[model samples]
Target chain A: MAGVKALVALSFSGAIGLTFLMLGCALEDYGVYWPLFVLLFHAISPLPHFIAKRVTYDSDAASSACRELAYFFTTGIVVSAFGFPVILARVAVIKWGACGLVLAGNAVIFLTIQGFFLVFGRGDDFSWEQW
Target chain B: MAGFLDNFRWPECECIDWSERRNAVASVVAGILFFTGWWIMIDAAVVYPKPEQLNHTFHTCGVFSTLAFFMINAVSNAQVRGDSYETGCLGRTGARVWLFIGFMLMFGSLIASMWILFGAYVTQNTDVYPGLAVFFQNALIFFSTLIYKFGRTEELWT
Candidate 1:
């Protein structure tokens, strides 16, 4: 439960952070900078979570399942955050080819997440046994 | 006070669990926001005077859809109580569908704007009415596929 909460918080915050960063760049007429910042922020945001997951696991405060859940959250945030900048840059520059790539990338992420949830998240409980 | 209670009341909600209630409310809210944002994008794409105006409208729709996605997920998370992976997964699926729909709408708006831009480039004129008509014809076909796919996916709504 704690792990899921952490994941939700992480994902939502990452989305909000990237949205704000894009808004800032849009206001400044910085075409490419927005995507660059998105890439950077996603790369940075996972470090703390990774460390926290490791620490929690080593200390036995959380189970392996919790750690795995944290990892999923971390990865989801990173992928989704990376998406924003790519989409923004393509739209801003009006590069249809690049936009197509962005669209394909988003489709992959969307499908991967959907697949993961469908396969692994179908059980009634997410206790350590499920992991 | 009377109106508030009346608005909150649902004829079939007497035995609904809290989680189900939350999910139902969140779904409706998400759908409403998504549709409203899409409508604005369509209007802006078809009628906006400038490319930048179209961009602004599309961006606004993106922003709103992003917020709606988060809200729906948050409510789903709360409803699942972190125990039922099945419920959580279903909720995520719902969110994904909404995200896809949002993307498609944004894409439609982008295409419309591009059609206008293309017309301007070719003729050095801002008469985009014909271009918009053509764009809409194609857009309807694309949107129909999306709606069809969404309907076929039953995990979330079921």
Candidate 2:
């Protein structure tokens, strides 16, 4: 049941994510920033599932690989969700300062995650060799 | 040997009979209809400028598609839950909330698309009453939700 629920949630979320990407592309002429932000948000939103999968799956090596993937996705999603909206709102409201702050905050989070991964030696398993 | 191993190594899980089949069919149909509706909206938005033409066509298609998808999913979810009324999987408060949110988002997108179409129409045609386009879009969303809530469950149960 949980697996079914997860699959459904992932599919529905993918649809929404696709729509966001399409809309961003369609409206890109208005500004590059909005499209960029939307893309970033979509890129990161699948992190939770990756994390959950890694944490739940058996085998330490597989778990570690999944954890790395999870961290990458989680950071991406959290930063983009928190940052992109504020950037959009800022652009909408014409507040460059707010947008800058949001961008900096996103950068901080991204760097922190990278630093953690590096320090912990959590290597990603997204190599062609695995295939 | 490979075929035998493939068959024998498979894991077993709990299985429901008819309900699982029904759910699978409904999900596929709903997904197709939803994507088709999206394609129609995108096509209309890119080409047509007249609100009346856009409203008439898009609303008809959008409303039908939205209702169809919602009904199918609702029925599928219900079947998955079965007659276990005491457990209330379908009626769970969180599920209901998420369902409502999904409906609202879909409806909201329809309305917004209609509004853009109306704006285009007002720019192109003087004969079309400007307010009518907006009214039609909003009304379609409202009516679709009503039909969805009150419509026969059997229409989607197959």
Candidate 3:
């Protein structure tokens, strides 16, 4: 029941995040959809982590090069996602208001992703690794 | 030259031991810096698309800096120190030479960006954002590579 409730909450947050992303793009005043490219970032952010997990051993060392490289790429992807809208706004390609909306959406969506990882990444019966 | 510089250097201290998270933190910081550099350059490109406004040739600085980034990180500290790497033709000397070339490229690009900023934009009294972007891009990438190279400890964990 607790897991079910958590899933429900996570889904609601994800929906809210998507709603904000859509509003930033589809709103009448903004009408620009370049902010949607952040979705590509969101889709690929977990890829490095997955690849690193598969490549590196679960060692007692503080960190491995593979994991650190993965973290570096993940951070790059995340910052690029935030920077994209700001650059668009700076270049007059998108409105500042739209940029703000997209930034907010990015925050929410990234948080939801993090939450999903935290909740599902446990190495237990209900672990996401099973998938 | 090395002996002269060693005379003025401060003795190394072992007082501060970094936490286990230092590697991850350093990588994240380096990544952020690297991404910011490219993003700033991209903003300039978008804002001023014409060759007259911002010369397309200036982007070579960034391209070289990125190449330097890869070159610098390709050899690990152990490999450079000849601890773990032994089979290569030049061995540790090869790693050191590679690192030296990488550093030279990084510094050369940075200086070139500065020259472009001053010669093309500042002296001409034209718009400076594009020039500033180029300089900042190379500078940030240089620092990012430095951090990624020296900010973490490479230990053989038993």
Candidate 4:
């Protein structure tokens, strides 16, 4: 019962995140879809970790240069995602309201992503081929 | 392989294992550097006067620095620390030479940034905000790369 509750909660949060992202881009006051570029960022942010996890099997040690490099890349991507909207706002390409909305969405989305990782990470190994 | 993992060094301590904390801080620093780069680059891109040539110069130099930063950290600490451990095509001195080249590229980026700051931003009597941003961004990248080098966990060759 609790497991189902958790899944439901996670799904709800994910929906909220997507709603925030869409609203930022589609709101009549903001009226700019450029903030949607951050969706690309969402796709990319987790990729380095996935690749690093795949390539390096030793779960005990996190000190591998290859793994660290992957972490570095991931951090870079995350940081860029945060900054992109501000730049758009600064340039007048997107309104300040849209930028703030996108930032909020970014926070929510990233949190959801991390939460999903923590919740499902264990089972992922068993279902590796499915992924 | 075992010997390579042995080369991952810690800053000799007696009481606490600072590894995790160190890694966390370094990751944050790298993120900060990445933010700095993005902010500066976009600022250059958006500025009204749009000093096109100067913008290109700063960007080219910034790209060089970032590439060098990646090059330096991508090489393993095992290859960097010990002379006897090299088994690659560059011979015993190969690792050392590569490290030197990486450092030189990083420094070259710094110098190029300064050159542009003085030539394009300062002499022209324009606002210093953009030039300063680019310079600090480059510097932050240098520091971020350096920190990333030191932040790693204990590994075993086996």
Best by TM-score: 3
Scoring each candidate complex against the real one, what DockQ results? 0.02, 0.06, 0.53, 0.41
TM-score of each: 0.28, 0.28, 0.88, 0.83
TM-score ranking from best candidate downward: 3, 4, 1, 2
Error of 2 at A130 (Å): 16
- How high a TM-score does candidate 1 get? 0.28
Off by over 4 Å in 1: A1-94, B1-126, B129-158
lDDT of every predicted structure (CA atoms): 0.43, 0.45, 0.89, 0.75
RMSD of each: 17.5, 16.0, 5.3, 7.2
Which model, 1 or 2, shows the larger DockQ? 2
Q: Pick the candidate with the highest lDDT.
A: 3
By summed lDDT, which 10 consecutive residues of candidate 4 chain B come out lowest? B149-158
Task: Give the least accurate 10-residue stretch of model 2 chain B, judged by summed lDDT.
Answer: B23-32
lDDT tens digits, residue span A45-90, model 3: 9999889888877656778899889989999999999999998889
Expressed as tens digits, the lDDT of each residue in B37-98 for candidate 2 is 34334434434456555444545535543554354335324533354365554455545565
The ten-residue window of minimal lDDT in model 1 chain B covers B148-157
Task: List, residue by residue over B124-146, the lDDT tens digit for candidate 4.
Answer: 99877778877877888887777
For model 3, the stretches where C-alpha displacement exceeds 4 angstroms are A122-126, A129-131, B1-18, B156-158
**Candidate 2 at residue A20, lDDT?**
45
Candidate 3: docking tier: medium
Chain A accuracy of model 1 expressed as TM-score: 0.36
Worst 10 residues of 2 chain A by lDDT: A60-69
